[model samples]
Target chain A: SQQGEEDPQALSIQEGENATMNCSYKTSINNLQWYRQNSGRGLVHLILIRSNEREKHSGRLRVTLDTSKKSSSLLITASRAADTASYFCATLLRDATNKLIFGTGTLLAVQP
Target chain B: SAVISQKPSRDICQRGTSLTIQCQVDSQVTMMFWYRQQPGQSLTLIATANQGSEATYESGFVIDKFPISRPNLTFSTLTVSNMSPEDSSIYLCSVGAGKTEAFFGQGTRLTVV
Candidate 1:
């Protein structure tokens, strides 16, 4: 069973607009990581936020984790057409084995 | 970060046949995992391939259907035995070092007919 659920299964916006995706999980996690996948390729790691951290930033990507709410969000600032892809959130549960539980994912389209 | 590679990028196989997918990492990794992604669905973990030991499968997956082998720290193989059309999906291999996030390989796209 999947532990996380991402909201707004699909989203569309202009190239310069910011795109936000939210994910909610049901279990306590050691870390939550985001990934991007192109049409038929493998996934690329975007960012990871530990349970103890509230927010993190990498380049134009920002991720926030609220342990109290058991949720997280990913914000892509100043998005580009190249940023159009499927985004997924994977959780590594505390004291669990090394496997990650992935969410359903969100498909984002950025029109140029 | 680790660079992982999978063999037979894509294949079309006949039903009742078997196919083995290989995964290789550029550097040594402590843990290797297999996942399946059906069309328009999320990825699901299949099993954990531990070096020189029996693989640990998830609740819905079993060793008889998706047998995994890890002969060393950087290489693992997953064989889909007695495959059927329903087994067609993308198989991905992921590697994780201690305290690091998992890194994925270019998944193997399998099509059973």
Candidate 2:
């Protein structure tokens, strides 16, 4: 079953603008990760935030997790045209198998 | 970090024909996973493969339709059997350390006519 939903199915922004995408999941998670996919290619891992941690950052990407709310968000600051792609949030359940459940993605189009 | 190589980056197949996608990892890994992504949609995990064991499939997926082989820790394959137009989608292989980040293959895009 699909674990989560991402808000703003599609987003359009200009270069240097900030883009934010949100994800909400159901079950308890050990960690939540952000990934980027250009066109229809493979996914590139961005950053991961553990349930025990509130937020994480890498380069121009910022991710925040709220366990109580069962939601998380990814913010890209000073976005560039190269950042235009589909962003996804995946959850690693605390269960034994350690399978990663991916959420519905957010498509961000950064216009140059 | 693991480097994964997947074969047949894209293919156009006739209905009723089957296609097998292979995934090879640079290093040995315990668990591997397969996922399917339909057009303009999110990825849905098909199954989890453990070396020397039967693949554990998720709901709405069957071993007969999508058979998996984990012959060893560094290699695995997924075959889409009795292919149909509905089966046309991008298939990806992934591997990860326990509860950590995952590494993905380039993905095989299958289009059935």
Candidate 3:
């Protein structure tokens, strides 16, 4: 079953600006991960924030996790047109099986 | 990270026919998974492929309709049988090598006529 629900289903922003997306899940998770997918393509792993980590960063991407609220947020700094894509947040539940439940996703369009 | 190669990248098939998409991974993994993404919708897990055993299918997915084959640790295949127009979507194969991160292949874009 789908657990994560992303807000701001679609967003448009100018280049050099920052974009933020939020996600909420129903169940507890081992980790929350963000991914990027260009049109008609595969997903690229962006960043992963463990349950123990409140926040983490990689390059210009920052991710924050709130296990108590079962929510997470992704912030992209200095967004570029190339960053335009559908971003999805996936959760790995505490179960032993490595199944990932994906969110509805947020479509971000970076205007040049 | 493990590299996955999936094919045929895209295909157009008739309603009564079947299409088997293959996924080959560079490194061995304990489990491989199949997911389907409908038009403008999020992906749904179809099944989990485990080596040397029958695949565990998810709810709303059946073994008769979506058969999965995991021959080894690094390879698997998913067959969409007797497909209909509704089956037209992106089929992705994924594997988790470390922690909770998964690696995906360029998905198979299937269009059932």
Candidate maximizing TM-score: 2
User: Per-residue lDDT tens digits of candidate 1, residues A1-112?
Assistant: 7988998899999999999999999998889999999995799888999999999999999999999999999999999999999999999988658769999899999999
Better of 1 and 2 by lDDT: 2
Q: For each candidate, report its DockQ versus the true two-chain complex.
A: 0.68, 0.76, 0.67
Q: Comparing chain B with the reference, what is the TM-score for each candidate?
A: 0.96, 0.97, 0.97
Q: Report how closely model 3 matches the true complex, as a DockQ value.
A: 0.67
Selected candidate, larger TM-score, 1 vs 3: 3
Q: After superposition, how far is residue B37 of candidate 3 from its true place, in Å?
A: 0.6
Of candidate 1 chain B, the 10-residue stretch with the lowest lDDT total is B95-104
For residue B93, what is the lDDT in candidate 1?
96
* iRMSD (Å), candidate 2: 1.3
Better of 1 and 3 by lDDT: 3
State the lDDT of candidate 2 residue by residue for A9-60, as single tens digits: 9999999999999999999999999889999899999998899999888988
Report how far residue A55 has shifted in candidate 1, in Å: 0.8
Off by over 4 Å in 3: B97-100
Give the alpha-carbon lDDT of every model. 0.92, 0.94, 0.93
Residues B22-94 of candidate 2 have per-residue lDDT tens digits of 9999999999999999999999999999999999999999999999999999999999999999999999999
The superposed Cα distance between candidate 1 and the true structure at residue A12, in angstroms, equals 1.0
- Candidate 3, residues A1-112, lDDT tens digits: the string is 6878998899999999999999999998888999999995899999988989999999999999999999999999999999999999999988987899899999999999
Task: Rank all candidate structures by their DockQ, best first, as comma-separated numbers.
Answer: 2, 1, 3
List the pairs of residues colliding in candidate 1. Answer: none
